[model samples]
Target: MQALRIAATGMDAQQKRVETVSNNIANMSTTAYDTRRAEFADLHYQQLRAPGAISSSTGLIAPAGIELGLGVRTSAISVNHTQGSLRQTGGDLDLAIEGRGWFEVTLPSGDPAYTRDGAFKKTGEGLIVNSEGYPLAGDITIPQDARSITINANGEVYAYFDGETEGQQVGALQTTIFVNEKGLEAMGGNMFRETQASGAPIPGEPGLDGRGAIRQGFLEESSVDVVAQIADLIEAQRGYELNSKVISAADQMLGSTTQLR
Candidate 1:
């Protein structure tokens, strides 16, 4: 009976691992997506005999103890914050970060959110917003009559008008960094919200003080590796099958015991 319970926990843990790997593989094409990994910890152990206990017959002390582990449990599902590959889109509004930092956007509820997805678009009112229509922080606006827009590595936005031979500064963009970026909570729509674990957001200009430089006309791709995920999937499947076999063996043994009349 104990073996049955222990093996059941293993099956549950492997099921969760499979789900996490599947999600990562599914998002391989998602822009700025980070893969998540399932972490597990061994359950508590039942100590049948204490270490260094004196043996009755030989009066000798034992060096090792008899302990049985309960099972495994999922500890945490952490996201990998590694940088993804950048692809050029040739669009004026598309942007990507070359290193660390994220773009700040205001949600519809007026809450501040951060995102690495830089596939932004200019609204009808000339306000820079993400694909979800969430406006970027600092209220950057482009002039409607501007012939062309230029964003530099420093995140400075400039617009060239017809009569003006020189480009005029429209607005500046800022990047936000966190003390513990992996601690941020991932909200849907390629956004993340600050949590107590993530600490406060550190605002700064791009390409300064460890902040990543802005790359216009480019977007960051998802960091998931398909081959690795497939390997993990196969491993999890094997683990699940082994645990199931253990349960089956335990059941047969129990059946034999009941058959003894």
Candidate 2:
């Protein structure tokens, strides 16, 4: 009976691992997506005999204790915050961070949200916003008469008018960095919110003071690797099969005991 329960836990853990791997594979094309991994810890051990105890018949101390692990449990599903590759989109609004930072956006509820997906668009009112229509924190707006828009590596926005040769400065962009970027909570819509574990958001200009530079006309790709995920999936499948075999063996032994009567 104990073996049955222990094997069941293993199956459960493997099932979760499969799910996590599948999710990562599914988001391989998602912009600025981070891959997550399932971490497990072994359950408490059942100590049948204590080490150094005198043997009943031999009167000799035991060298090692008899311990059996109960099972395994998922401890955490941590996300990898490593930077993804930059992709050229050829769109004026598309942006990518070359180092470390997230774009600040104002959610509908007036809350601040952070995102690495810089596929921005201009609203009807000329306000710069992400695909979800959330406006950027700096509220950068383009003029109607502007012929073209230019964003530099330092997060400066400029608008060029038709008649004049010189470009006018519209607004500046800013990026937010977290003390623990992995600790931020994913809020869907390719956005994240600050948590206690993530610490407070540190606002900084792009390409300055350790902040990432903004690359215009580009976007960051997803961090998931399909080849690696497939390998992990195969490993998890084998683990699940082994655990099932353990349960089957335990059941067969139990059946033999019943036939002894």
Candidate 3:
């Protein structure tokens, strides 16, 4: 009976791993996408000892110890916050981070969220916004007639107007850091929110206090590795099959005890 439960646990763990790998593949092209992975730990084992309650003539030594692991279970599916690669797109609004920091964005709920995606654009009102129309944090706006826009590694927004020899600073973009970025929970749409486990936010300018520097005309690429994921998938499949065999063997042994002749 307990053996069946043990095998069931192994099945569940392997199934979770499969789901994790699938998600990683789905977001392989997503900007700033961090990979998700499942963790497992073995369950407690049972030991059998003693053939009789009282044995005066025989030694009091208990029967040889036998470890019977119940099963394996998933411990956690943590988000990997490793940095992604930066790609040049030749777009003024496109931005990418060079270190550990997140660009703050306004959410639909009027709350602030963080993102690594820097595909930004200017609205009709000259408001700098992301693809979702969410305004960038710190309020950066450029003139409609601005000839060309440029940003510096220090997050200084510059605008070049017609007949202007040089660019002028229009706005400043700031970055936010966390003590435990992996603790942040992703709410989809390339957004992430703070959590207690993530600790408090530490705001700073680009290239200051270990904050990430800004890269104009670039985007961050997903950090998922396809080869590693496929290998992990195969490992989980084999593990699940082995557990199934254990369950079947236990069943056959139990069936042999019955005699219908």
Candidate 4:
């Protein structure tokens, strides 16, 4: 019965692992997506014999203890913060971070959200916004009459007007960094919100004070590795199968004992 329970827990854990791998595989093409890893911890143990106990007959101390582990449980799911490769889209509004930073955007509720996806778009009102129509935090707006827009690697935005050789400065973008990037909560839609674990957001100009430089006309790809995820899926499947076999074996043993009685 104990073995059956333990095997059941194993199966549950492997099922969770499979789910994690499947999610990573599903989001392989998502822009600025980071893979997540499942972490597990062994359950409490049942102590059979206490260590360093004085032996009753031999008058000697026992050096080792006997303990049986209950099972395992999921501890945490950690996000992989590894940088993804940048792909050039040639779109004027497309942007990407070359190193470590996030673009701040103002949500519809006026709350600030951070994102690594730089695929920005201009609204009909000339307001710069992300794919979800959330305006960029700095309120950077493009002039309707601008001939061309230029964004430098240093996060400087310039708009060139008609018959004007020189481009006029429009707005400077800022990058936000967190002390614990992994602690940030994923809000879906390629956005993240700061949490107590993530610490406060540190805003600064791109390419300064350890912030990543802005790359216009580019987008960051997902960090998921297809091959590795597939491998993990297979491993989890095997683990689930092994646990099922253990349960079957335990059931058969219990049946035999009952038959004997």
Candidate 5:
């Protein structure tokens, strides 16, 4: 019975791992999508030795009994933080983070958020925003008739209007860092919300205080490694299969025991 329970637990853990891998594959093309990896831990062990059944007195039988395991359970799911490669899109609004830092922005509801994806665009009001139309945190806005938009490595935006003497600074971007970014809770759309476990957000100007420089005309791709995810998927599948086989073997053993005279 204990073996059966343990095998069931193994199946459950593998099922969860398989689900995680499936999600990774499904989001392989999603920009800035982070892959999740699951972990498991063994349950508590039980002693089956009978009370007052020791051999010190009778010297007949030993108090030996197998220690049964309760089962296993999911321990954690760590988010990988490796930076993705920058893809040159040649779009003026397209941006990529060159190092460790997240572009701080507010959600459509004005709630503060952070994201590694930098595929930003301009709204009808000429305000710099992301694809989801969320305004950039710095309240940076540009003129409607601006021409020749340029974003420098230091997160500064320059634009020259049709009749302007020269390009002017129109956008000033900032990034934020956390003590533990992996602990930040994902809120979809490649955005993350601050959590107690993540610590406080440290806002800094781009290219300063360890924040990453903004690369204009480019976008960051997803950091997932296809080969690694595939390998993990294969291993999880095999583990599930082996657990199922163990359960089948245990059922057969039970049948044989029932047939004993």
Candidate 6:
């Protein structure tokens, strides 16, 4: 019966692992997406005999204790924050970070959200916003009469008007960094929310104070690797099958015991 229970836990753990792999594979083409990994921990152990207890026959202390692990449980699912390769999109609003940092956006509820996806668009009011219509922080706006726009690596925005040899400065963009980016909570849509574990957001201009430089006309790809995910899926499938076989073997043994007259 204990074997049956222990094997069940294994199956559950493998199921979680497979789900994680599935998610990663599904998001392979998602912009600025990060891969996730499932972590597991052993359950409580059943100690049949104490290690330091005196032997009944020889009156000597036991060297090793008998400890049987109950099962495995999912400890956490950690996100991999590795940088993804950048692709040139040739779009004016498309941006990507060369190193580290996040773009701050204001959610509909007036809460600030962070994201690595730079596929931004301009609203009818000339306010720069992401695909979800969330306006980028600092309220950078473009004028209607601007002929062309230019964004430099330093996060400076400039617009060129008609019959002018020089470009006028519109508004500047800022970047946000975190002490522990892995501690941020993923809110889907390539957005993340600040958490206590992630510490407070560090705001500064792009390419300054260790923040990444902004690359115009580019987008960051997802970090997921399809081949690796397929391999992990196969391994999880094998583990699940093995645990299921253990449950079947335990059931047969229990059936044989009950058949004894």
- The residue-by-residue lDDT of candidate 5 on 1-261, one tens digit each, is 667988999999999999999888888888878788898898987877654456566666664655677888999887888888889999988888898889888886778989988888888888888878888898888888887788888888898988877799886787888999889998888899999999999988888888888898888888888999999999999999999999999999999999999
Which runs of model 4 end up more than 4 angstroms from their true locations?
none
Count backbone overlaps in model 4. Answer: 0
Stretches > 4 Å off in candidate 6 = 57-59
Lowest lDDT 10-residue stretch of candidate 2: 49-58
Runs in model 3 deviating more than 4 A are 44-68, 258-261
Off by over 4 Å in 2: 51-61
- On residues 1-261, what C-alpha lDDT tens digit does candidate 1 reach at each position? 899999999999999999999999989999999999999999999988888888568899888988899999999999999889999999988999999999999998999999999999989889999999999999999999999999999999999999888899999999999999989999989999999999999999999999999999999999999999999999999999999999999999999999999
Models sorted by TM-score, best on top: 4, 6, 1, 2, 5, 3
Per-residue lDDT tens digits for candidate 2, residues 1-261, read 899999999999999999999999999999999999999999999989877878678798888989899999999999998789999989989999999999999998999999999999998889999999999998899998888998999999999998888789999999989889889998898999999999999998999888999999999999998999999999999999999999999999999999995
Model 3, poorest ten-residue lDDT window?
48-57
Q: Relative to the unseen true structure, what is the Cα RMSD of model 5?
A: 3.4
Deviation from truth (RMSD, Å), model 2: 1.6
Q: lDDT tens digits, residues 1-261, model 4? A: 899999999999999999999999999999999999999999999888778877578788888888898999999889998889999999889999999999999988889999998999999888999989999988999999998899999999999999999999999999999999999999999999999999999999999999889999999999999999999999999999999999999999999999994
- Per-model CA lDDT versus the true structure: 0.95, 0.94, 0.89, 0.93, 0.86, 0.95
**TM-score of model 5 vs. true structure:** 0.90
Task: Supply the TM-score for candidate 3.
Answer: 0.89
TM-score of 1: 0.96
Candidate closer to the true structure by TM-score (higher is better), 5 or 6: 6
* Candidate 3 residue-wise lDDT, 186-239, digit = tens: 888888899999998888899999998999989999999999999998998998
